[model samples]
Target: MHPLPQLESYAIRTFEIDCNQQLTIPALVRLMQETAMQQVLELNISVWDLEQYSLAWVLIRKRIEIERLPMLGEKISIHSYPTGADRVFTYRDFRVYDEAGQQIATAATTWLLMNLQTRQMSRIPAELLARFSGYFPPVEMALPYALDSLPPMEQAFTSRNYVVGWYDLDFLKHLNNVHFVKWMLEALPEETLAKQQIRRMDLLFLAEGNLHDRIDAQFQQIDEATYLHQLVRQEDKKVLATGRTIWV
Candidate 1:
């Protein structure tokens, strides 16, 4: 068997940066995910292949820690590989560095295999497990805790409704997970974004939102820089996603 490929390089585009000239959280999340997907596809188990097996990769939890967001016009090299699996959950680690070789961020994410037909969790296949059997580096940074479970705080904060736009849909025909992070950050107070930078962020996707779904977003300020947010469908009040952000 060929050794699994382990790293990829990406350019930091001007549109990917924020007003401060640093990479935005949504763009960073997209990069990490794209790198991982590319690595997996190169290993022969492409998304189309998984679909043929009636399987799909569903992201359950993700956490990222940033020492410093890379600036625009820089190149980033990302190193990533599957760490291991636990029953139905497969874990992966990503480490990013600037062109100068300075560490920028580290992230670890958990994914669950889903039975595409039934829409339920599925067990790991033997062949899939064997692919990651040998020699991979351990996660160097501390794995972050899962996002906290939060109660509805509607009375404390005003909620705003947003229409899922055509641009928000991905190949999956649903709102891309990174856009949930984007919406959560956009819902924050302007002063908060101006003064604080995200040190860590955790997100849990509970349900999928389709085009035309009305999403109600509500946020609560835990403190000056920490916040908890929730997004849900307005029709049935079904929860869509929850996120917790820590800023410094």
Candidate 2:
């Protein structure tokens, strides 16, 4: 269920810059999400209307590979398209560009339809999924383990957590991937954070998590800043997604 009409573009704002003077990774992602909202609104599927049915679309998982960060005062254009929609799942794709038209990042994301009251997975309404047709390239929802999986975590990587609250949820309802990464990055040390830059990142998903789930992000130092990151259940230590971000 891809929507085909136009590519959504965004303007940069002052507050969005990170300490390194580039747009914060989270803000870049927020812009990509903003573009999708514009597409949906152009299709006449207002956020207010979706709320009427006690339904919301939640980004289940996303992967972003950035080439270079954009600095302050630069304008951006983001093209967003639906990959396709499947029962209980919808795929979204994005390409971000800088003022000079060079590509900055490419991200593909998956979303799931959820019932507000029960907070359970539900099938995408046929009409809702069809709204995206003609707009997205042929895309498919990824199944677990097929993307890739990692081995079990070490014992040191257990019983940590960051709570789910109003601010943690993005426009998409699920926890933002950057927030997950931020927690993973910050949990280490400033020395590690300052010296190492992420060279490669691979993340795999196993389940959806939300409010009050008692989640903890775990890590093992490969060397310097490189690490194996795991998001786990606090009680059982069930693996949610295993990730690796290597530092250069």
Candidate 3:
């Protein structure tokens, strides 16, 4: 049973805050993702290492529940560990705590190792999975399920379209998951953002986007503060990602 790796003493910077003066959903998600990357690198397997075998890691699904968004200048600690792997899916857990040690947020994410050249799921090496040994944290809840198809809209409540550029790509040469959340948030009117704070989010990545790929982003309100979002390939209309966010 190996101890979970942790990124501690993170100071919430002013630049990381949203209009509401608290950590933004995209920023928080980025921190967790960075933590996961660090965990794997500590095991002596970097993204370039995976690339040598024509492999890359892709996030399949994520569910984040934030009890209280940390504010500017607060020092926090993030702990994460690979819970286990099943087939081609690897599950990981994350916990965030305030300076006083009070828990503030938790997340569970599923990732898949894939053949970059073929875009097919790849099996994780036994040695790679063995490093985790005995660090299996119980999931706070079931991981998010795949999003249902978005119902047809007379027109997108709010939509944005743009081409994928170099800045949008991660090491995998595809849209970074945090940017998906950022684009979704950007679709909302300024007034809506000023009045609400995102508290829960579930995202599922359906397809990958390549450099110069044109993306059509759409947002539709599900209720007062819940919205459904989708990103599609403009040329083929293939859905790239779908997500739902709940705000308070």
Candidate 4:
């Protein structure tokens, strides 16, 4: 296995950019996810490799800080690597840069290994940790803040309902993580989306949503530019995820 981190280059495509010509948050996350998958595949520790052991990776938390959003047609580079692992969680980080080599964004993510059949969290395997020995010295990026202690959602300032669709499910048969961000933001007012850009976002996934599940996305204003968000399954009233976003 290579000890070096992976670096991939890409051009921001038209579909990846929003109406304002800036790359959307979900699009950036998709790029990061793809880059990480490519790296693991090259190292022979990808999801397919793990599935042989009845293990699968699940993203539990992620935090992103945006310096600037890349415009459509802009060339950018993403550097990704496994940071480290604990008893129950593994870490990865990403650095995004523009063509000029200026850092535009950075993200840190935490993942858990789950037993495919049991649907329970598993401890990090020593052999799996050894595969990333060469990629030591985790990048100095800000970790997801307050993920374990999200702000209370006393009252929802705005809310929306969504019925999980077929396309929303990922390979695990659960709603993809990125859609949670989209749903959370959908609960915000149009004026908030139009006037402000998200400077930072923190998300903590607590449970999974399945196809046809009714989800209530709710947002509570925390301050002038900060908000607390939650996605709850309507039938059970179970909170699937909690998040906070700071807008500028």
Ten contiguous residues minimizing lDDT sum, candidate 1 = 135-144
Give the residue spans of candidate 3 off by over 4 A: 138-158
Q: Each candidate's TM vs. the true structure?
A: 0.90, 0.75, 0.89, 0.93
What residue runs in model 4 are displaced by over 4 Å at the alpha carbon?
1-3, 138-148
Clashing residue pairs for model 1: none
Q: Give the distance in Å from residue 188's predicted Cα in candidate 2 to where it truly belongs.
A: 4.1
**If the candidates were sorted by their TM-score against the true structure, best first, what order would they fall in?**
4, 1, 3, 2
Candidate 4's TM-score: 0.93
Candidate 2, run of 10 with poorest lDDT: 138-147
Angstrom error at residue 161, model 2: 5.6
10 residues in a row with least lDDT, candidate 4: 138-147
Model 4's number of clashes is: 0
Tens-digit lDDT track of model 3 for 1-248: 53565675688998899866788888888888888878778765567767667877788888788889999888889887777677788877788999999989988778888887787999987776666645655544324333344344435654788788999999767888888888877887677788877777777888988899988878888788888888888899888887778888
lDDT of 3 at 136: 59
* Clash number for each model: 0, 7, 1, 0
Residue-level lDDT tens digits of model 2 in 1-248: 33363466666667886566667666776787778878778876555658877787766666667787677877778887676666777777777888889978877677777788897988877677656655655434322212345555565454357776767765656666666756665566556555555544566666655666677877887666567778876767676677666666
| lDDT of all predictions | 0.79, 0.67, 0.78, 0.86
- The best-first sequence of candidates by lDDT reads 4, 1, 3, 2
lDDT of 4 at 119: 93
